[model samples]
Target: MTTSHVPAGAHPNDGHAGPRVGLFVTCLVDLFRPTVGFATVALLERAGCRVEVPRHQTCCGQPAYNSGDRKEAAAIARQVIAAFDGYDHVVVPSGSCAGMLRVHYPSLFEDDPDWGPRAQDLAGRTHELTSFLVDVTGVQAVNDQRHDATVTYHDACSGLRELRVKAQPRQLLASVAGLTLLELPDTETCCGFGGTFCVKYPEISDRMVTEKAEMVASTGADTLLAGDLGCLMNLSGKLHRLGKAVSARHVAEVLAGMTDVPPIGAADGGDRR
Candidate 1:
């Protein structure tokens, strides 16, 4: 619900030499973890981008789209497209939302001669954060950020398959000073938080997340990380219920050195940026 340019006063870099980025802060991050939004700005700033958060931005409408509500989804997509019309690039912290904006939005309006071109234009400019940093900005490393914990990573389905975000996060995490990256078995598998999928099929969703949580625990890593908050929150809850000690966080938090807050779903974690 915030149109603020940056979360918690995270400003762009001094020179503002890079592309002007309009951050598409997803609903999950805005509501559940504003720190992820803060970390996103910090990471983008560190990568030399001039970042802005447009106040008029709203949901990417994945839920409605996934539910086969094309009319409502297109209405939402047009709002997002209009809100972020002028940025050099649109960056999102969550791959799910980014995929919606980048991949699905065009198809949602493919038949509409008026909105189709706009959706396609917006789609071309949209990118997930890690991919934007590594692939677009040529940022190969994260400097001055160190997390001394052994961690495993999960590749959310949309980002991994739709956007091909496999090695982008790994490439950046490699630069963290004291961080050890443990590769999760089946890292590319879906975490079952498929927007509304989990809600519609709770039994199947629970089974998938339970297995995914077990895989995370098997790594024996102290922390779990991914680019999408929805997956992290789902797996975090499952891990907590299963009594696992692995903490879950967004990759941006570690990359931006913003892990002072407790892990997602930790009882002590409050809504503070």
Candidate 2:
């Protein structure tokens, strides 16, 4: 993908004025769920942030790093670290990527004298999307159209276990007008889409997602929501494959009221819900 550069002054800091944020659009959201990216921009802008989508940014090296490919992982990690080096903070929509940036990057460079500290510094400033929205930006709610639908959220593994991104997205979702947040059974269980793990172990992935789908189905919610696209995609794919009627959406998409987009596998002219 060709990198798009945002000139230094492209995003003017008007809200907190702490640090201009380099919005890290993860590969999944970039390719499959562009609406999530747009919603993220809307939420951050609503929260008074100077958001910039740095074109040079790419994968967070989680897949490579998790597979024990340190050399390639470090190379990509270095590129990501350098791309957003001067930004005040790196805001990412996915918990997995945010955790990788905030947790793994520093470890990747721990032994290096120069890049190690740089990675640590970058890690220190990284914030998951909802965390930045509710905590850093102090945003209480979004002013989107009211949708009276019961929604349940799935906590992605890296974000929940590694980054502790549990309540932030829920809090933000609860604040959305006319939306009722429903509780899911065993909400914290892994959805089995651990990057390449699903591909490498298809059977296990299928079983995990099937169980997750069952939990989501039991909620009687019209919509199933989650922060990370990986979990959403996995659960949604299985749900679609099974011909279940529940619709799946990203938290940002719900909060931003961009529900006009069709659910997974629907035809272009088909109904969204």
The lDDT leader among the candidates is 1
TM-scores for all predictions: 0.93, 0.91
Error of 2 at 31 (Å): 1.0
Model 2 spans > 4 angstroms off: 1-19
Q: What lDDT does the true structure give each of the candidates?
A: 0.87, 0.82
Best by TM-score: 1
lDDT of 2 at 270: 71
Kindly list the per-residue Cα lDDT of model 1 for residues 182-248, writing each as its tens digit. Answer: 8999887888888889999999999999999999999988899999999999999999899998899
TM-score of 1: 0.93
How many times do residue backbones clash in model 1?
A: 1
Each model's total of backbone clashes: 1, 1
Flag clash pairs in model 2. Answer: 4-55
